[model samples]
Target: MRNHYLVIFILGLLLSGCVTVQLPGGKVTSAKDVEYKQPAGAFKEIASADADKSWISANTGNTISYFSECGGKSEPTLKDLENDAFAALNESKTLSSEEVNYNERAARQSRASGKLDGVPVELALIVFQKNGCNYTLTYGGLAKSFSAEAAAFEEFKNNFKAP
Candidate 1:
């Protein structure tokens, strides 16, 4: 059992490898190099990465649509991502109520939240120049669960990385 545990641990590290990220600000660093807490527990379901390296993410507490796609385009400006985020959220029934904005600090990412078909939803988007990709984390749940979903999504943004 001890030997097996050791092997598993080593493999885990190997699998994670060295995660490098290039923020929109042109700062290149590894995932471990960044200081952010990835939300735990809330996000439980994870699917395999597809051709574009996109996958679905789920919260342990609720069933909603959440996904992340890494790749394509090199524009890492927060403004660019913010526009994209807003457009995506436009599909929601409550776009008029959302306050979409860009975060200039800490990687200069874009975040937005609002309701869709009576359900609340939030999004976190970022661009990684090093990885040559832009990714988004979209989560939706009950109106009452908006706070929780936002918190969990924030955790994910706080710990987000690329390359």
Candidate 2:
């Protein structure tokens, strides 16, 4: 009887592993084929478990991170993601925001300034969705030199390609 119960439990586990989990838009095994040209400058890849790719400027402290989330049962809208982005910062306010086309899809670009660890920081965020995955690009640096970093971020943002 004990062996029979063990066999049943093993079968259940095997079946569960075989079961496919589908996302809202579709099934996405991983975020692949998304491409973007790195900004021209001394940028280095940084380690980030949460981000698919991340970079930091050797010249400036500016950093950029890109990530995608597999759609859930109810994927959040761009506005929702944008609001969440600002809310993640301390005392952040939108400086400007506009809709832009990104890889032929509607995308939102936002600029803001906020405090990080009590230090003033400037932020830029672009959010869009494609192929059952939501993509986000975040750029941030010290508020004082943010303008200088903006061009690099723009270059990176403009060259983004969705797979």
Candidate 3:
């Protein structure tokens, strides 16, 4: 009886060692190399912890910001990101939005008006998903001067590259 008990214990140990365990995959932090051209002219690169990249126009006080989100199990859709952003701005209104192609990927471009800190503001933004990441590039300024950097924003969006 003791021998039999010892054999059973050894078998249990062997079986446990042979068992394969599956662990969940690690979440992706970001792409290996995220590359994009800055907006043209007086837009100077600025440091921003919230954004992967950012630029400010000295001439107009307009700003361009780019940020990325790593798509884990629950990757967000373009509309989801857009709606969340618009919701954050007080009195936000979408002036125009359309589907477009950027870097050979489907993207959405939008023009919006809203208030920030009770000060009127206008925004132009492009949203796209690529390589397990969602990216947003936005240009914003005082409502009165938003148009000053509108063209540069277009150029910046056109030059974006996904890693």
Estimate the overall C-alpha local distance difference test score of candidate 1.
0.37
Q: Which one wins on lDDT?
A: 2
lDDT (10s digit) by residue, model 2, range 1-163? 3433233222212211212346556654446787788767867776665567777666665777776666455567888767766765678878999998886788888988876656677778888888777777887776776677678878888788878
Which RMSD values do the candidates have, in order?
11.9, 14.3, 20.7
Q: Which 10 consecutive residues of model 3 have the lowest summed lDDT?
A: 11-20
TM per prediction = 0.43, 0.79, 0.79
lDDT of 3 at 93: 92
Q: What is the lDDT of residue 102 in candidate 3?
A: 79
Q: What is the per-residue lDDT of model 1 for residues 73-144, given as tens digits with 9 covering 90 to 100?
A: 245464444454455343443232223332232343444555443334444444333344343444333344
Candidate 1 ranges with C-alpha deviation above 4 Å: 1-39, 48-77, 91-106, 118-120, 124-128
**Candidate closer to the true structure by lDDT (higher is better), 2 or 3:** 2
lDDT score for residue 157 of model 2: 81
What is the overall TM-score of model 3 with all chains considered together?
0.79
Number of backbone collisions per candidate: 1, 0, 0
Per-residue error for 34 in candidate 3, Å, reads 2.2
